[model samples]
Target: MPASAAKSTIALIGVPLELGAGAAGTVMGPAALRTAGLRAAIAGLGHHVVDEGDMDVPHAVPEFAPGELANCRNLSDVAAWTGEIHDRALSLLASGALPIFMGGDHSIAMGTISAVSRFCAEAGRRLVVLWLDAHADFNTPATSPSGNMHGMSVAFLCGEPSLTPVLGERAFPALAAGDIHLFGVRSVDAEERRTLVERGVDCVDMRMIDEFGMSALLRGILDGLDPETTHLHVSFDVDFLDPELAPGTGTTVPGGATYREAHLVMEMLHDSGLVRSLDIVELNPFLDDRGKSARVAVDLVGSLFGRSIVHRPSPRA
Candidate 1:
């Protein structure tokens, strides 16, 4: 039997912290998404959308003294932002609203996923993560060539060592490796790949997507999800799309998921009805061409919330 198609109350929480990424300007992502009409797109799908506005990190982000953690930058600011995001995310879940966390960078997922994991634990639901990005993002602080904290989010959420402080006082349970599925990955560091293999994380890289096609690969993954018991969180990085399509990300990799492929993934997930939360990350409007990437993102979100081309009305002359 197919899952019920019902309108959902979606809480959009904007986090504008860019301290975790390798560059400035990602802090403008939330605003870009909003400007691109993300709210109206979701509402068009018959969902109730609540704009929670933007959240700020503590005014005085702690200063991590020298040698606190080698090869990691902006530790204090990132930690403060993550902690705040975690707390607010929990509150939104408790309010019975599915969260759409609009990010400043991928690093915010550490807190967002942690909050969702805790909610799933308390609700007796299985937590699953679908990571849609160009990079694997499995680099630990020690393994990262660049000290950007965004690259380390997957490791932190999967219980890797040396970055636990990002969660601050929160003690959310780490998601198991098998519960994470990395899709559309085309860029990965050498050690990051090793870590993913060792942890038994499922990865369907672009090469695999080319071989098996997105429909077959995505369906295989979604087929295993129990809609009644599983809470699926999609962590979508804009870099997952080809730079030609979405050039607003700091980390743009060539040969990513095509426009149609991305929408198909969203539509299939919507049909499965397992998605509970979402993180739209790595959108750097500072590098965008007239909000092109932002508009693309909003369109994808519309598909995820149940938009269909077949239902379109005739255009007025």
Candidate 2:
């Protein structure tokens, strides 16, 4: 059979995180996307699909009150979710299926990405992260004012200290600075910005996208990827969309990537065929204009799986 004729399996795991942001509505992300038929939609593309449902994250009735900078209000809940999802993802991969985590919050990236990294590492494969977000999420407990774990997810994934323990006894999945690529970033703390620059992470900010054109900048990004060399994880934050299109996101940023630009990125990713995992994070349907944000998210996932422009999951030869 031809390589392109092979089909693949995709498992959906939802992570609803209301503990990581100020706007307080992302916990509903999983259900929202699900209600929008995230599962059936992907399955319709002719891939094997399994809805693992949502991970059970306990409420964070804090044992101790949190401080200003140590904003660990829901530390236990987030940590527990991290542990459970890590194992869940690993378990799913062991079943020979790719995992697509429907996120509760951006903080959950710690678990979802870490699990995929460990899986690839054990299999002697390298992992690449395509971080699509408005903020860098590279803050540390010491540096963050809000201490929202979501704000600090990227920093921890790249081997920063303070919270690697969330991966359980096994180590957190850390990456080489060059392996992680950040796109459409418009907001960054001064310290996080400095850290990202010092570490040499590939960040194509909104200004860079505007200056160079999305297609040109994206070409450079795609050219940098060696599909044969990587298992890509795309972490798409709802905030990555302009508020006009995805208003459900808690951290709505103005002047985000337009709908067309967003689709182009997904299409390129599909063409590369390097994506092995995905995350649809930070959708706060409470703020949504109907179900517009969730629909767009589903559409983007559709593009990643191959829509009219790209085509569904092809076999890895």
Candidate 3:
């Protein structure tokens, strides 16, 4: 088992801004997670789970004009959410809480990661992002086939010029491309694949997982970390799981991780005690089958915080 974090407060910040996504229902993701007992599940792990509630998109726009990225849709709205979330994330970290950034879409990562990067920089620590998703999400506005900002999140965070102004007046510590690791990826755009190779990112794709197993591939990632100096941030997109198991996500990719495979990943992360922050994104409850996906997400969170299958407690009747 991994060591436990010294910090006891788990702050939940919901980013219910969906304009970053190509779909609509992800705006309700936070509410769905809460409804599925996320807070309760975390509290059950002996952590103080504080629900900060969903962030409200600013009605008043900032003075900095949104970038005119041609292929990126809803640039202004995404920029607004990015700024708001960045502020909130920094505040949560300052309070000495391990923040769980509940997302409306994968694009919200632009804010969460930006804030964490800044916080780590100020603390003189290194920030490593674990991107668990189906797609690479490394497309720039110029390379993106779709106009969805979610597809361009990874690119933006790595200092892509297309969305450079998304952070507004606040300074963004752009993450080093090599520090971002992609896991469970099975889908990638032609251009995005090229970008990943050019950036020299460490991607443990489905093919590799099939060959060496998730545990071995993930262990390689965990082994390289310096637990004290590395502030690990896990950006989990629901579509990283096979659609048959997590059908609520808008961008469903086939041949993703199974339920047990995902649980084991979270369990390993729990033992590592290196994760300081997290982002649970791209869950669209509107497409779910009676909250099945939400329940699975909750279960995965349970595993992340040290819930083990062998010693699991029984639910109330």
Reference-based TM-score of each model? 0.95, 0.91, 0.94
Residue-wise C-alpha lDDT for candidate 1, range 1-317, written one tens digit per residue: 22214688899989998988997988999999999999999988788999999996677575565653668888888888888888999999899898999988999998899999999999999999999999999898789999898999989999886777667668988989889999999999999989898999999999999998999998888786777788899999999999999999999999998899999888877878788899999999999999999999999999888897775321210
- What's the lDDT for residue 22 in model 1? 90
Residues forming the 10-long window of minimal summed lDDT in candidate 2: 60-69
lDDT of 2 by residue, 155-195 (tens): 87998866655454767558889888899999988998889
Model 1 lDDT-worst window of ten: 308-317
Q: Please report the TM-score between candidate 3 and the true structure.
A: 0.94
Cα lDDT computed for each candidate against the true fold:
0.88, 0.80, 0.86
Give lDDT tens digits, candidate 3, residues 1-317: 12234326899988887887877899889999999999999999888989998888788564444345866788777888888888889999989888999889999999889999999999999999999999999989888888899999998889887678777778878889768889999999999998899988788899999999999988888876877788899999999999999999999989999999999999888777778899999999989989989899999998888688686432210
Per-residue lDDT of 115 in model 2 = 86
- Number of clashes found in candidate 1: 0
Off by over 4 Å in 2: 1-6, 58-69, 309-317
**Model 3, residue 190: what's the lDDT?**
94
Clash count per candidate: 0, 3, 1
Residue runs of model 1 more than 4 Å from their true location after superposition: 1-4, 63-68, 311-317
Residue 128: error of model 1 in Å? 0.3
Better by lDDT, candidate 3 or 2: 3
